[model samples]
Target: MNGMTRIEFLLRLTISNPDVHTAIIGTLNPDHLKTNIAAVAAGPLPTELYTEISDRLAKFSQPK
Candidate 1:
């Protein structure tokens, strides 16, 4: 997944799980780090997008 998708996935995972306190992401490049920060600043994914992602993931679990 792209950086933004990965970030949103991480944020969504944390938001879904109350037990999760924090998510630690590592990046050495300044630009990537800045982008990651921006992603966090953008806040949680919208409900529609979150549901879409969840649906997509759910498909993977179904018997094929």
Candidate 2:
């Protein structure tokens, strides 16, 4: 997510939700207006992928 380009992040989010707002569109350059642009560029994950990641986190967090 950190290394993802602005274009790649938007494309990934759209893949999960076609209704997602496009207001997030903007440049990745560090500037006052570009805030939240980083989140948009982080991309959204599919439900399954998100669930799997959460499960992995739970496993790691369990007491040994």
lDDT of 2 at 10: 46
Candidate 2's residue-wise lDDT over 1-64, tens digit each? 4465556544564655645555544555667345455445555766775456558768989999
What tens-digit string does per-residue lDDT give for candidate 1 at 1-64?
Answer: 3345766667655565445677888889999888777777777666676677679888999998
- The Cα local distance difference test for each model comes to 0.70, 0.57
- By TM-score, the best candidate is 1
| lDDT of candidate 1 at residue 53, scale 0 to 100 | 68
TM-score (C-alpha, index-matched) for candidate 2: 0.38
What local lDDT does model 2 show for residue 30?
Answer: 68
Shift of residue 10 alpha carbon in model 2, Å: 14
> Which residue pairs collide in model 1, if any?
none
How close is every model to the real structure, measured as TM-score? 0.61, 0.38
